[model samples]
Structures are given as structure tokens and as C-alpha cells.
Target: MPENRISRAKLTTDIVLAGVFGLMSLPFALMGNWADLVAMALFVSALAVRRLAPAWSLGIAWCAATVQMAALRDLQFYDFAVLGVLYSTAAHGGRLVKWLGLVSAGVGALIATVYLQVLMPIFGDTSGLTPENLIAAAFILVASLALLVLAWTAGLLARSVREGREVRRREEVANRERALVEYRYTVEQERNRIARDMHDVVAHSLAVVIAQADGARFAAKTRPDAASEALQTISGVARGALGDVRVLLAELRHREGGAPQPVLDDLGELIEGVVAAGLDVRRVETGEPCELGTGHQIAVYRIVQEALTNALRHGDPGAPVEVRFDWTPTGVSLMIANRLADAAGGPGTTATGATATGPTGARHGITGMRERAQLVGGTLSAEPGGDGVFRVVASIPAQPRSTA
Candidate 1:
């Protein structure tokens, strides 16, 4: 609809311009110069289609000049329309027409010089080709050519400016599309990180709470004090889980509202919570600890949390879990092992009766852990052994802190 409106407007503008040119040439029609009137009418018609059909406009202009030369008439005011036709050919015409406009400018200038200087005087007077007349003719040809070429050059400049604007507009659109794609990619990555954090926090906490609650229920009548301690552990674990959930929700609501994440120092509290849930955990550290960047630390912390959570959920209740960390100058290696709940294999279980941690088994939790390890330039593996034990081993390389 808008395109239609613009086209109508351009057509209206061309009609008005043609009308004005015709009105200006009305004097020739009134003066009874029939040939001049005919040429003016043709030139006016060319002006009407100057932009809409530049090739046709150029043709009409040549016909007007031919009629005027055949009558041996002097250049009239409406003859200026030839300049407009040439300009339109360069500005609005296709490749062939644009070059043709230049050729027409040169040839028309030469022809006009000959018709006015030689042919007109031959028919109207007895003047011969004197040196002064020849020199004047040369000046006239140069001037006419310069004027026509200048008009064409102006049209070419306009074309260049329009094309440049079009190029800039396309570049802006491409930049916007690129930025939108990057934004979506960043958003997806952040969402995955949040999901991993939520799983680590909620899953571990619920597992501990469930164990404590079950123990409390079984020991309530036999040992009231033991039941009370179990209830306390459950309460603490639940409250901590609630707080972590609130923080995660805050981060969801406001991108920059994330709380400080757990680091290596917080592992002690993690282990203590699991122990209070009635699982025995043994920790062994070998070699000196090395510094790790924030991202690497987060990866290490989440991997350990997930591994311990899996053991608490799937391992034998009476068996002790072992966590070993071997640190070197470059990085740390971690191994966690626990006895299986059942010694005989069954559905959803390995040969050792431990829950399968492969893609088809405990997929989500193990996959999350593996992704975290890889994010920090590390590797992780989880499998159940023939000895009825499930093991998780990871090697994480230290990374340098990023500068601001």
C-alpha cells in the first residue's frame, strides 16, 4: 500500500513538472512558430517520463532536436529539457542507458554546434567560414559539451549517494541479526548453568533430609534422643535447601542477583551435612593444593556435590563412602567410591547391583557432572566395579584468573 502511494506521488510530480514546462513554452505557440511549438511539445513529453522511463525520455529528446534542426530553427527555452533527459538517463536508467547518456551528451554537443554555426548561417545568410567564426564555433562546442557532461556527472553523484545509503542500511540490519543470535546463545548457556546449580543444591539437600527423616522415624521409640538429633539434621538441611532455592530464584528474576557460589572452603559443611544424614564418609588428601580460578572452582565444587549426592541416594546405607583428592602444582584429581545397595544386579543396575551411570541410566546427573568437568578443561568417569562398588573419578586442570 505504501509503495502504491509513493508511486502515485512520483507520477503526480512528473505530471506537474511537464505542465509547468508546457506553460513556459506557450509563448512559442502564440508566436506562430509551428516547428518550435512541435519541438517544445516533444521536449515536454520527454520531461514527463524523464525518471519513469529514462531511455524513452532520451529518445523523445533526440526526436525534438531532430525536428528543430529540420526546420533550421534557433534553440528555444524548452530545449533545456535535453539536459534533464540526459541527467535522468544517468540517474535512473540501467547500465546500458547510463553509458548511452554520456555518448549522447558528446554527440549532441557536436551536432548542435554544426547546425547553429554552419547550417543555420548557410540558409539564413551569406556568411562564410571565417577564422573568427571557426574559433567561436570551437568555444561553443566546448561549452555545450561541458554543460551536458556536468549535468550527467551530477546524476551519477546522486546515484552513488543512494547506493551508499542502501549498503549502510544492509550492514546495520546484519549487525542487528548477529547481535540477536549472540544474545540467544548467551541466554541458553546461562540457563544451563542455572539448571545444574539447582539440581546440585536441591537433590543433595533432599537426599539428606529424606535419610534423616527415615532414621528419625525408625528410632523415635527406641532412642528419643537419636530421633531428636536426626530431626535437627533434617531441619538444618531443609532450611539450607530453601535458602539456596531462594537465591536461585533471585538469580532468575534479576540477572545480576546471584549469590556467592560455594567454593572449596565450603566442602567441609557439605561433608558434615552428608555425615549427619547417617552416611559415613572418609576423606583423604594427597599432595599440596593448587590455586584455581573461580570458574574452575565452581566446576570442582559441583562435580563433588553431585557425586556425593548420587552416593547418598543410591549406595548401601551401611557402607562407608570414600572421597580422595590428589593435588599437584597444575591441578587436582578426585576419586569417590561407595558400596552398592544390592550385591546382585537387576534392572537399572550394573553387574555389581549399583545404579548404572551411563547415558541410558542415571543420565541427567552424570551428564551434568561431566559437562561441568569439561567446562573447566577436565574429565570425569563414573562406573560400577565388579567388587559391588560404584566409583566416580575426575581430573581437573587449574586455570589462571582472568584480568579485568
Candidate 2:
């Protein structure tokens, strides 16, 4: 498609050039009578409106030229006004206009050179073909060709500038789109991470509280003292849940707040707490003492805690649960696996202080655990083991992890 804007701009410049050239030619035309002066004025006035309508301007200039030629009975150098019109047509007009303008410019130059050199040879008495006249004709032809080349070059430069600006605008828009996409991706990842952490916290805490509460209610008649102890354990578990939640909330505000940091070393105490609710837990380790960072230590502690809670809820009652921690040269690895229950546990009941089943298979609890492991530059996998047993295994690097 043609660029109307470029066409319009070139047309405006054409009109201005026509006006300046026409006015400059007036002094020479005015050496004649009042008729000549008035005609020149009218002709120049028409140049101002060339851009308003290019075809009309060409007609006007042509008609004025015919009148001027008639009154003078000869053509002068100023007869080249039509050349300006031709250039405008080639530069800003249609394809048909361009071809017509080029032909007209060439033909007009030829006729004017012939007329000036042969018919009206004012410079010399001899008017026939001569070396001087031939040289003048050659120069005029060359000048016309130069003008054509100039107009074409100007048009190309204008088009190039417009395209450059357009390309820059597209690049800016692409950059903005890329930034927006990255921002959305970061937000989604963060939301998933928070969801996983919340699932682990709520599921483990509620499971422990419920299990203790159930045991307390059942033993109230047969063993009143044991039942009171179960109640006390439930209260302690609830308080600990509150503390855990508070610590998590503080973390959201960029503060750890001197909260008690749980680590692998605390596994025994954690297991004892569950056993206090009348559940059996067996702990095992396969590594020497290793110093772990604060955040990673908490992460490892939570992993083991969540696993034991899961076993309590779903594993065989009175069966054994194995908790293993292996510290290797590369990193620390944790595994928690329990013997499966032959008979399904009661709904929402656990003597070990845990839920009978997790939120559903595709829910966030287990998925959260896996993500937490990954966040610390670790890997976690949970699935069915042999003979109805479920296993949760995690390997987290001991080196500095990526905070992001």
C-alpha cells in the first residue's frame, strides 16, 4: 500500500517549492505590460494550492504556461515551472502519474531546448544547429536526469526513516510483553510454594491434635489419669501449633524472631511426643553429627515431622515406623517409611496423634512437602512401598541453597 502520509508531506514540500520558484520568475515576466503582470500573479497564486489537489495543480500550471507562451509568443527558461510539477508527480503521485510525469519532463525539456536554441536564439544572429547549442541541450538533459534521481533518493530516505521508527516501536512493545510474562511466572511459583508450606503445617498440626483428643476421650472411663495426660498432651500440641503458625507468619514479614528452630537432632523428642499419645515410634540414623543451616534445619525437621504424622494417620496401629537420616559427603538424606495397616484405621482418628488419611491424592499436602524439598535445592519423592507400605524420601544439599 502507498504511504499517504509520505505522499502528503512530499506534496506539501512540492507546493512550497512551486510557490518560491513561481514568485522568483515574476520579476522577469513583469518587464512586460499589465496583462503579463496580472497573469504571472494568478499563475503563482495557483502554486499555493498544489497539495490540496495535485492533479488540479498540474492542470493549472499547464494552462498558465500556455497563456504565458501566447502573450510572450515564445518560451523562456522559466518555462521549466512544469518541471517542478512533474517532479512532484513522480515523487508523491500515483504510478501512472509517475510514468506520465517522467515522460512529460523529458519531452518538455527537449522541446524547450529546441525552441530556445533554434527558434529564439537571442544570444547570437546564427540560429541553426551549432556546437554551443548542442552543448546547452546536453546540459539540460543531464540536469533533468539529475533532478529525477534526486526525487527518487528523497522518497527512499523518507520511507527508510518511517520504517526505522516503526521497528523501534515494535521492539519496545516486545520488551514490555516479555517483562510482564516473567513477572507472572514468578508470582505463580511463589504462590505454589506458600501453599505447600501451609498444607504441611495445617495437616500435621491438626492430625496430632485430633489423634490426642480421640485417645483422651476413649481412655476417660478405663484410665482417668491416662486420659487426663492425653488431654494435657492435646493442649500442649495445640499450643505448639499456635507457635508454629506464628513463626510462619513472622517469616512472611522477613523475621524469624528467635523462634525455636527444630532440626534432625530433635527427631527423638518429636517421636516421644507422638508416643505420649499412646503410639509406638522407632527412630534410626546412619550418619555422624553434621552442622546444618537454620532454614534448612527447620525444613528437614518439618519433613520428618510430617512423615511421622502421616504414618500415625495411615500406618498399621501397634506396628513399627522407621525414621532414618543419612548424612553424606554431598548432602543430607531423610527417609520415613511405615508398615501398612491390614485393616483401615478409623476415620479422623489416630492414637499417634495424626489424621487417618491425607487431603486427597492430588491435594497440596504431599505436593507441598515435595516443593519444600526442591526449594532447598533438594529432591523428595513419596509413593507406595512394598506390601502396602508408603515411603517418603527426601535429599537436600548441605551447601548454600538458592533463596529465590
Candidate maximizing lDDT: 1
**Backbone clashes, candidate 1:** 0
Writing each residue's lDDT as its tens digit, candidate 2 over 167-255 gives 99999999999998997787666555455555566766677777878887898999999889878888887887787777767655542
- Give the CA lDDT, 0 to 100, for residue 294 in model 2: 62
Relative to the true structure, candidate 1 reaches a TM of 0.89
- Worst 10-residue lDDT window for candidate 1 reads 1-10
User: Residue 168 lDDT in model 2?
Assistant: 97
Model 2 residue 188 distance off true place after TM-score fit, in angstroms: 0.3
lDDT of 1 by residue, 1-404 (tens): 01112276787798799989899888865575788888989999999888878888899999999998998888778888888888988888889889999999999999999987888877876576667767878999999999999999989888899889999999999999999999888778887888889989988999899898999999999999999999988888899899999888888876555589888888898899889888899999999898888888888888888888878888888999999999998899999998878745567675433366543334678889899999889999987887888888999997776686
lDDT of 2: 0.65
TM-score for all models, in order of appearance: 0.89, 0.59
lDDT of 1 at 380: 95
